[model samples]
Target: MRFSEEVCERLDNYVYRLIDPRNGETFYVGKGRNNRVFDHAAGVLDVADDDNQTLGSKLDRIRAIKSAGLEVLHIIHRHEIPDAAVFEVEAALIDAYPGLTNLQGGHASSDRGPMNHLELIDKYSLPQFPSNPEHRLVLININKLEDRFDRRAIYNLVRYCWRISKSRAEKAEYVLAVVRGVVVGAFKPENWMSATRENFPDIPYANGSELHRIGFTGIEAPGDIWNLYVGLRGKRVSDPRLKHSQNPVRFWNC
Candidate 1:
């Protein structure tokens, strides 16, 4: 059901959740203006709008509920949110609900999303990254990193399979693996290579056709260099420009 014009005006930018009537689970979390919340169940999205696999899943779920002769439950978790603050609200909700059908994390969710007690302590205690780094640096968010303790896993996650410009990617000397705005590891790229099965025989490719992505093979940054950016204590990124927002990649001095 669509919101009335007056209700829409009062709501302004708001965060909402779509619940599965069959199980009362929130499947989607989103933020928008007007009757944007109702659009999903109204069948506004199609295969053409499948920006990611998750959107397609969301559509399928909505269809299933409708076919079962049930209506999807919509909840306005928070309303009249300021335009600037809505992203954080939406992201917080998305993090609170783990299995949401959102295509991407909330804006700046990688940088300032959920954290455990130890992570919270580390986030505040670590040294801040250089505000003006002299080295041509590429800040790659390893937010999706599954293995936090493995050095090899951190390196592999930071170095492989990214959709980026080859020429621009090669210009950077160092890549910083960031997790929740903290520089977890630093590396110096020795080579930039296409993300293909031939180039990376170790990685399992979904198909034979080479993908249009590039990754790097690198060694850990030298101790002196590492200490400057990331030490045993780790480095926290405080600069707004350095924060990993929607894009998993950001460049500095390049």
Candidate 2:
């Protein structure tokens, strides 16, 4: 939704709100120039592909709003402000609205505002990965066993069973990938709708298997102290007990 440079010049520097028509709720709030508001309104149909998931979910929400036969009401909260002040103002408005569909929130600032994504993650204690969680975390040993065939068994487990619980798989939060006693990546759950050729279509696989699902995402790695290392290490997902073990699916507790 690119606007001409001329239009963008005139529209620069503004914080906006999108009002839902069905129940008159404010589903989203954002700050931008060059028709960022309309971009959200227009992006409902372009759900994220295997390449990107962040933008697609926001678009999905907007599409749902439009599908309700209601249009979003765009309101300019403020305009003609200094570039630095925009972040301050945007963060304040976001803080005012307790629950907004705005996936990425306000930017960094010198004052109190919505915490940045990483801050929010730590603030809220996210990635509370538990190897023995009643939920799930599919720990993939970076290297396969010398005597094994492939990740078929681990795949079936992650795709089927819950981490700690004996019951079948259900809601799962994160999957921490470990390598030789070090945590390399943390993936968040995305959407895997089916088992078709397209099911979990976006994710890649070492075996070229279509079952390489895409419902999970790799997130930022934790601090060095939390990263797993050889010899006795920290607790939770960082435990080094699995350092020399061939087990692909290990456990971690928050």
Candidate 3:
């Protein structure tokens, strides 16, 4: 049947049909402008259109008819129907035709449940921390600080490391390196003990004083302190004299 613009313009208040020729089944039932019928017939509907399987089934029926050398027989329109009435009518019409029944819902179904922490981690593909010698050792040292050190000591160490590191960027690398060393056994424990004693020999280990003398502090509350230590240690390793000058008191603070 021919579709005219006039018929489509009047379709706003009606339900429309595109039927299959071979089995005489109702394939699609929808409420829209008449021009939409042509658009559907042309197979240009958006993804959401699949939500109405009756329409999809009808289109398939039409394809079967074409393959069997039959032409579309009719395009019917009934005007002045509310959207609710159109839906009811379409559902009833589809139910009436056994051949046109759609048992599965229109869209694809998913079996997934709410995501937990592990699922979230997997979905995002979070970085896998080093599992072998390097990272395992780092994790051990990270845990040790929790057990063996006070917050203040950690803070002082980190702060002192920062002071002598030369630059902020280098400080971060230095701290990370120290932590890594502790974890992987790269730096000997005895060496660390000696270095700590050499840097801070006095009592109360007052803030800024011991740090000024030895140029290294332990990690403290403000976790970023390690960054500074890392930088200074990196520099000191590269050039021993970087940490070799007599305490600042002899040079500037006297």
Best by lDDT: 1
Better of 2 and 3 by TM-score: 2
lDDT of 1: 0.83
Question: What is candidate 1's lDDT per residue for 40-145, written digit by digit as tens?
Answer: 7554764443464547778888999999999888989999899789888999999999878886778778877888898889899888889999999999887566
Task: Tell me the deviation in Å of residue 133 in model 2.
Answer: 29
Weakest 10 consecutive residues of candidate 2 by summed lDDT: 161-170
TM-score between candidate 2 and the true structure:
0.40
Cα error, residue 172 of model 3, in Å, equals 50
Give the winner by TM-score: 1
Alpha-carbon deviation at 185 in model 1, angstroms? 0.9
- Candidate 1 lDDT trough over 10 residues, lowest sum: 45-54
Q: What are the clash counts of all predictions, listed in order?
A: 0, 7, 16
lDDT of 3 by residue, 1-254 (tens): 43576765665655555666666656555555556565665545545644443355555666776788776554545665776576555444443434433422111111122334643444234232222211111111121133222434333333332223222222221232222122111211111212244455542344532332233333321333333223222111212222111121110110
Q: Candidate 3: lDDT over CA atoms?
A: 0.36
lDDT of each: 0.83, 0.48, 0.36
As for candidate 1, its clashing pairs are none
